[model samples]
Target: MNEREILTNYVYKMVASLMQNGVEDVVISPGSRSTPLAYAFASTKNISIYRQVDERSAAYFALGIAKAKAKPVVLLCTSGTAAANYYPAIVEAKYARVPLIVITADRPHELREVGAPQAINQISLYGERVKWSAEFPIPDDAPMTLPYVERHIARGVSIATTAPFGPVHFNVPFREPLLIDFQEELPKQTFRNSLVGQIAPSQQAKELLTAVINETQRGFIIVGELALGTDLQQMWAFIRKLKWPVLVESLSNLRTNVPEDCGQYIVSTYDALLKSSIFKQQVAADTVIRFGAQPVSKFLTNFLTETLPTNYIVIDEDPMFRDSAAVSTHFIHTAIGEWISELSIENTVFSEEYLLKWRTSEELAAKHIQSYQEIEQDEGAVVRFLIENLPDNSDLFVSSSMPIRDIDTFLLPTKKDIQVFANRGANGIDGVMSTAIGFSEARKEREMYLLIGDLAFLHDVNALIATRYQPCKLNIIVFNNDGGGIFSYLAQSTVKEYYEDLFGTPTALSFADVAQMYEMEYMGIEDFKEVNKIMEPQKNPLRLIEIFTDRQQNVASHRKLWQRIQQELEQ
Candidate 1:
């Protein structure tokens, strides 16, 4: 085979291998260096390609797609800074345990450290943020590199999909004849499945569990972000039978029909919950049973560490904990589902006094919700409107800082099918809007609702630009509070002089102008009552609905809600 034929065959085989291995999506950022890989991926019918010009946005876009689909997604970018731009998403994938395959084209080894354009140490660009990294050396002769390139690509995919799955890097270096177009049929390669089998719990795990149940009167079960295929029903059944106070994070998949009166167990990741002395007291337990991934909020971690349980049993398929302060007394190395199944057969139950206290605390929280400004004609009200009006079967992607915090506290979705997503990996507000757009594109059939703050919405304004692919009907509701509304509730908001300059910096730009620039439909609402009226149904492209609120009032309203809840609890 000629040089062109070898390169073409290599690219075809790699793409084919990825598709066959269950990777269905690829986010490609256009550039000359990666032209061959991009063309090969695009021409392949089995894989879906999303075109994003900005590498940073493209990486996050791929992150969103992977996160939503619960599958490994590939990100294609050119060498140099274009590849470096994937660092943020890489860190997020590592921390959040999302599977991402990063593919970057590079210059041949001969050109390295010689000041060649777009050439830098491509190896380990992501440092320790990724699970694995490899440099595919260029062939001395084009034909020799084909098999090596094909093998490494397949290996990278496997490493990413394995347990405690995370992002993986593949740096492919090509020489002068980068543009290769050979129609020759490429031979396919099959990859060996190297699955990570779980180790059965040692005698120590069982002994530890027995000691905790014997010693502690009050035990709490807390579940965080679990993997997609997790058996939630089995776990829930175990907890319900025990009548234990179970605190569940939004992503835990355990936030189901557990009665509010069960206890002061359902913790909130919002401002009101943060200030609740009562809620804090309720969480002070003798023991805690932790399952799944880490919670997104810093407050929750602080609370867990400060109110240290005598024995904290952490159950996870992957034994690693991303949060530094999370110290486990007992680490069960088996799958959480398996552990719960075994525990359920034993028929364990907690003290009635312990269960009653939690139920009372939940009553306090419920009363608090009823007292909070009734979600009317303001920021709080807008959140309430969404909770009530969000269409059935719609997926909600909330922006960090304000939107997610609010939803976690106030807006509880009525339906279990309405999945909620956010960039809690890093909690950065930069690419939130764009990430939601990518999510909408990935799940093209379902309608997506994105709730964002004004500042976050403006950060990725360019993401709203048109693409060749048909735009997903993404309904975006922008809380136009004119600045970072969240800062007003934080301690930093007290610094009157620097508050607006640093934290609450308002852009003073109009969403209407942005809509015109992007050629998207726009709706502006001054009153919260108009939220439902404006957010009805829409077709194609994208729709932006802006709601205005007073920064001062939003803070006050949230405060009042907490106060009301406290009063109800006392009564």
Candidate 2:
């Protein structure tokens, strides 16, 4: 066979293997080197090709798609800096456990170390940033070459979508005259992946957890950032079976669509409640059961650290050493729902008073929040209005930094079933817009919203390019505080000398111009009541609703709100 057949055979098998392993979407970064791979992906059946010029945005877009669908999304980029640009998103995908198969086309082996242009040692390019990385050889005279390529594709997808799933890298070096022969239908090749069953908790582990659960009346089940497609019903059922208070993070997506009685145990206002010294002192947790990643609240983190619990247990399916407080008595790595199911104990009387205490605390803080909402038009009200106005069965992607905290604080538990997402893995502000763009692509029918700060919005503003081609109904609510508003709430704010120039890092960008440049409809508003205009999508699908806010005023308002909550809780 000629180079055409060899390349065609190899690339076709790779694409088929990806599809066989349930890869529905492929994000393509257009370049000369990746032509063959791009053409093959486009030619395939039941596959989507989202062309993105920026590799960073493309990688994050793939992350968003994989995250939303709970499936592996493939990213194709040419070698050199195009692949390097994926580093940030790769890091995010690894920590976030979002499955992404990053494929980079590289120069052939003969061109290595000879000062070849567009070639810079592509072997294991992503290093430890990816779960698995290897150099995929060009299709040649090797025996079983087609099968080998197909098998490796299967393996990579498996590794990516397994327990503690993450991004996997594949660097394929191609010679000149890269094959783009998709005119004639190539012979179909497919590989079946071995079933990856859920790893249940060991009997001994179950017995111990059950024993702890039996005695745990004053326990708290803390749910952090859960994996994508996590069943809220199962989480709620587990909470019900244990009858323990569960402090839920917004990203867990377990806080909403809860039953009416869920408010009794579901602790959404723990961020606010833990701020009160009196409430924190009164709320005692002996056996602390934890799941997912760390909580969003710094105050809650402090509470956990200060009050050392006897049985501090953490059950994570995506096993990682996330114990920041260094107080985990037993770290059981298994599926949380499975662990809860296997527990021998039913609901027993631990401390009804403890749950009552939490419920009352949440109510008090919520009351203050409500009263504050009625009086002020701060970020909390901004977030509150956004959450309250969301259509049923929608997706909300809140950016990191202030937006994440704002959503967590204001997103009350409701029956609306709003799915929330955030890049809390690395928790960086970069790629916020791109990730949301990709998320909207994956969930095409759902009403999508993005709550981002100005810096984050500008970081990946080029992501709006994807919307120009792949249009989706995305309501981007960019809270333009003119700069890093979150810094004002941190210790760096005390150093006023270098704060504004360094930490403040204000980018007084006019997002209206950005909207016009990107050809997206723009709306600017100040009054929180104007949020009522946020309604069903009409003529324009891609629109930016920019709300200008003051950084200093935001800090003052947040501290004042926290003080009021603490004062009321102390009463």
* lDDT per model vs. reference: 0.73, 0.84
Which 10 successive residues of model 1 have the least lDDT summed? Answer: 262-271
Candidate 2 weakest ten by summed lDDT: 183-192
Angstrom error of the Cα, residue 2, model 1: value is 2.2
- TM-score for each of the candidates: 0.91, 0.97
Q: How do the residues 342-409 of candidate 1 rate in per-residue lDDT, one tens digit apiece?
A: 54223244566766666666655755564454553467767766765666677888998878777777
Candidate 1 wrongly placed segments (more than 4 Å):
139-144, 182-186, 190-203, 256-274, 278-283, 296-302, 323-327, 344-349, 370-376, 413-416, 466-470
**lDDT winner among the candidates?**
2
1-571 per-residue lDDT for model 2 (tens digits): 7889778878877887888888899999889888888889888877898988888988899998998899999999988899999999999998888999999999888998899888788788888989998778777868877777888888888889888889999999888797657844545664556567775788888888888888776889899988666766678778776777889999888778888766678889899888777787788688998888998889888998899888999888755757887888998878656457446776476888888898888888878776776767777777877787788989999999999998888877788969899888899999988999899988888888899999988899888777766756788988888899898888998987988899888866768988888777889887777866666464588888898888888888888888888888787
Highest TM-score scorer: 2
